[model samples]
Target: MESQPILATGRLLLRPFTLADAPEVQRLAGDYAVSATTLLPYPYPDGLAEVWIASLREGAERGDAAAFAVTLARGGDLIGGVRLQIDAEHSRGELGFWIAQACWGRGYATEAVGAVIGYGFSALGLHRVHAIHFSRNPASGRVMEKCGMVHEGRLRQHVRKWGVYEDVDLWGIVSPIRAEIPHPLRSMPV
Candidate 1:
């Protein structure tokens, strides 16, 4: 659940995002570098962050998604958010995340994604969990890879941002008990 606070990783904490986190979320995620990687835009407004926080709360209760604010465990500083969308009927889920500019290159994304994926598999009993990111954000691709999701394919010109279309690389992980083996992406040649 989006509003439900979660335990932090050794390096990061995934917390429930309330209306209070709006300002910090906007400040961190509203930057050009941060927003460019995700679907959000630069110069985000005051109320936009509040809306997003509320959306997370609403989504979680409605079972549309489970999202968390990524924070530093020691200082409890907010940086970004990670999401998991559950498809209970199929026993699958989708993973997504965005970290602030200041936290870039610190492996915070990997820590957060790995924790969430573990929650997906162990807690949610999901048969499969997947993710995708813009090709422009190679670092996120690395996060997915490091989190054990294999790069399945690239969807060409699949998403339009600002005025142009962008490509996205799809990635996924699943239970080895199923018909296929769960390949930890660390072995991939990519």
Candidate 2:
């Protein structure tokens, strides 16, 4: 991978998923707000979290496209997660992210995700990077904007969530390696 084994920011460290972080993964994934936007089952159990984390680690080893956890370098605690998954042909990858509600005010997701995108462009040698969010969640749209993705379009009633058909917000950032927008999204101070 062109991206180094790991990436770090002043307050964050983006590294591959590992089974050892299962407990923190449980705490964050188990949160309702995080799960609500993320499509993670609301009552995500500790065991499920363990399995999910284990699977992510395994997937990376198998050459599956995936992401690393966003953790505080100081405490080494999982504050969030960012994933970049490539489709089978390896042409493009999707960017996914989630931050614990408790960490929302801190701009952590923006920084971590941006760093990961840089990794993908430089190291992963990927071309297209995009993200989709349930329409009910506009914060995700903002995150995409913060990351430098242009407004592409909206898919009306594209998915079913909690038993009702729902819409989706689709935004994409393509690094031709020389796009006018030189950087990924960055959170603007509110």
Candidate 3:
């Protein structure tokens, strides 16, 4: 498979991860505020970031997933990461992301996710892209909403996190055609 290309947005750049990014990944993703809200383990172990970055290439090669390092377009500082876990047979992918705690509420997550969702639909020819967040983290859901993703439904106690079952909210956006049509019970747009 061809390598994932760098994606650009108005204020952000989504590019392939590099070994040099390990330090910052460790620093930002290590925080419980970041890790606890996602699947990442708390007290992030040493060298795990490097291991994760290395696996991204392998996953891409196997056509299973693609991960991107989210950075600033101007200064190129690594601030977060986003990923698309592909299910090619179904023409869909699962989206996931995290931003540094310091960058919260700045619209960076929405910008980065929008760029990747565009890539999934336009570049990868995907039919749909979906994401889920722990129910406690509504901010993450807001990012999905801002990217035009509709709230699909909530999975009750669907995931075991930190020894507790956590509810998850699923959100998704289908291709443009699917987005335009109204449901059978709903009136058409004027």
Candidate 4:
């Protein structure tokens, strides 16, 4: 197990969430507009952010997950988050991210996602990484595409958001380390 390293992009810093960020995380993620499209609940229960941030430490210790607080590089304001729920047994990880509604369209999500994907491959030894977005949120899908992920498929009614079922679009990218070595999906016995 290793410490979660900070990931930086030109405009953003992807760092581990500190309890100090709990207030800003609550303010931004609590917004209905931000929670509507993602799984985060509206009203964003009090103290949950702190609890969640604390749990991330335990998860990281187990190699089960890595979560980063997305912030501005210049001003250092916390704006959002990006995380990987790692499946160590399969050598893969599931990515998830969100930016405050006010911060939408700034490319922060795309930048942070690219950095985390790199960390997953280079640091975590992941063979592949994947993400899922509610189909209605094409903007998020676009972010995934901008990061070089391929749209794998759509899972209809795969998730219930705010009580209504929604379709989820699946996207994935293989580690460049693995991509360089060409291989078949199957091996035939001759």
What lDDT does the true structure give each of the candidates? 0.84, 0.79, 0.92, 0.92
Question: lDDT by residue for model 3 over 1-190, one digit each (tens)?
Answer: 7889999899988999999999899989898999889998888899999999999999999987989899999999999999999999988999989999999999999999988988888878788999999999999999999999999999999999999999999998998844565667676556
The local distance difference test score of model 2 is 0.79
What C-alpha root-mean-square deviation, in Å, does candidate 4 show against the real structure?
A: 1.7
Find the 10 residues in a row with the least total lDDT in model 1. 174-183
Query: lDDT of candidate 1?
Result: 0.84
Give the residue spans of candidate 2 off by over 4 A: 1-4, 88-90, 178-190
Candidate 4 ranges beyond 4 A from true positions: 180-189
* Residues 1-190 of candidate 2: C-alpha lDDT, one tens digit per residue: 2333879998998887777777878877789888877777877775887788767766676655667889899998888899888763744778888998988968788888888777777776677788899988888888788988887898998877678788898998887674555344454554
TM-score for all predictions?
0.87, 0.86, 0.91, 0.94
lDDT, model 4, position 109: 91
What TM-score, to 2 decimals, does candidate 3 have?
0.91
| Tens digits of per-residue lDDT for model 4, 33-148 | 88888899889999999999999999999999999999999999998999999998989999989898888987889899999999999999999999999998899999999999
Which model scores highest in TM-score? 4
Candidate 3, which ten residues in sequence have the lowest lDDT sum? 177-186
Candidate 2: RMSD over Cα atoms? Answer: 8.0
lDDT per residue for candidate 1 within 68-183, as digits (tens), equals 88989888899888889889888888987898887788999899989988877776668999988998888888999998889999999999988899999999988654536455
